[model samples]
Target: MTAAKHIELMSVEDYLAREELALEKSEYLGGYVYAMAGARNAHNLVATRLLVELSKRLEGGPCSAWNSDTKVRVRTNGYTYLYYPDASVVCDPNPGADVYHDRPVLVAEVLSPSTRRSDEGEKRIIYSQLPSMKLYLLLEQDECRVTVYRRTAEAFDLEAYSGLDSVIPLPELGIELPLEPLYRGIENA
Candidate 1:
């Protein structure tokens, strides 16, 4: 007979404490910590471009754009999840914790092959639980494509944009992001 493996879970306090001194970044979900993988050049380029654009557009506004180093806290189904999105915009910043943002108006993830499933499935579902989140973006690294989820009175509205000439209108934050600049210098993107 095959033996079942036992998984030891870490507490939220311990996880936070460890993260304070850890050399690398890891996401906390429930009671488990998942190590983050290093991003590729394409991923970095895409994420950086998005961050730059968001920062420029959000300047002098209530919302501020943050890089991947900023963690977002989401609580749902009796579990606390701390995710490091590729880029995030928070109009209402949490004053209690400097390391994480509890209320983010927009969250963006540059999709990669290694993390596509979780980003599209698990992360998407969990992020929706945040009442402050109004927009979610899934940007493709290898192509000029983006999947946008905008919150409505009833539910989230899904939209997809492709091609370099396409533009994404984010009226929630009063910003319009063009795909040409986002995928600039990215070959075949």
Candidate 2:
């Protein structure tokens, strides 16, 4: 007798329908529902740190900073996908009522050893599907380096900075963040 192979997962909507009353948040994608993973210590620290600064800078502004609790909806070929980045800033608020944001201007994820690949790879592609997104930022968990992806008329281009002396520029929001204080107190990070 041969072992049976598992069937592929369902779409984002189907997964959500099945787990209507579930406690944990789920990210819906093509035939898959990824249980929202709790961040590692370093992940939590960096995310919190970034949010604090960004929030302060964006206070009373048109842009709002949302934690990972917010889900970004990506629509492609009529398919809808949901992903939760560590932190995101959105100018639009019409994602849904009592739910996550749909159209975001900037999305940032702190890259860990586990999530580094996907956060920098697959998520980038999915995020590009959103026309509202202008910048996608990736923060390294073990270092003070940051990589920013900016969308241009032609294509997206990447710019990298290491340490606090470097500033992360968000021309879309007319803001530039000083990287030095964001990485303070990161252990071996």
Instruction: Compare the candidates by lDDT and give the number of the best one.
Output: 1
- TM-score versus the correct structure, for each prediction: 0.95, 0.88
What is the lDDT, from 0 to 100, of the residue 155 in candidate 1? 95
Question: Which portions of model 1 miss their true places by more than 4 Å?
Answer: 1-6
Ten consecutive residues with minimal summed lDDT in candidate 2? 92-101
**Candidate 1 residue-wise lDDT, 80-133, digit = tens:** 999999999999998856789999999999999999999999999999999999
Q: How accurate is candidate 1 locally (lDDT)?
A: 0.94
- Deviation in angstroms for 101 in model 2? 1.6
Clashing residue pairs, backbone N/CA/C < 3 A, model 1: none
Off by over 4 Å in 2: 1-11, 17-20, 95-98
Which digits, one per residue and each the tens of the lDDT, describe model 2 over residues 32-94? 777866668877888888888888889888998999877787888877788888899988787
What's the lDDT for all of these models?
0.94, 0.83
Clash count for each candidate, listed in order shown: 0, 4
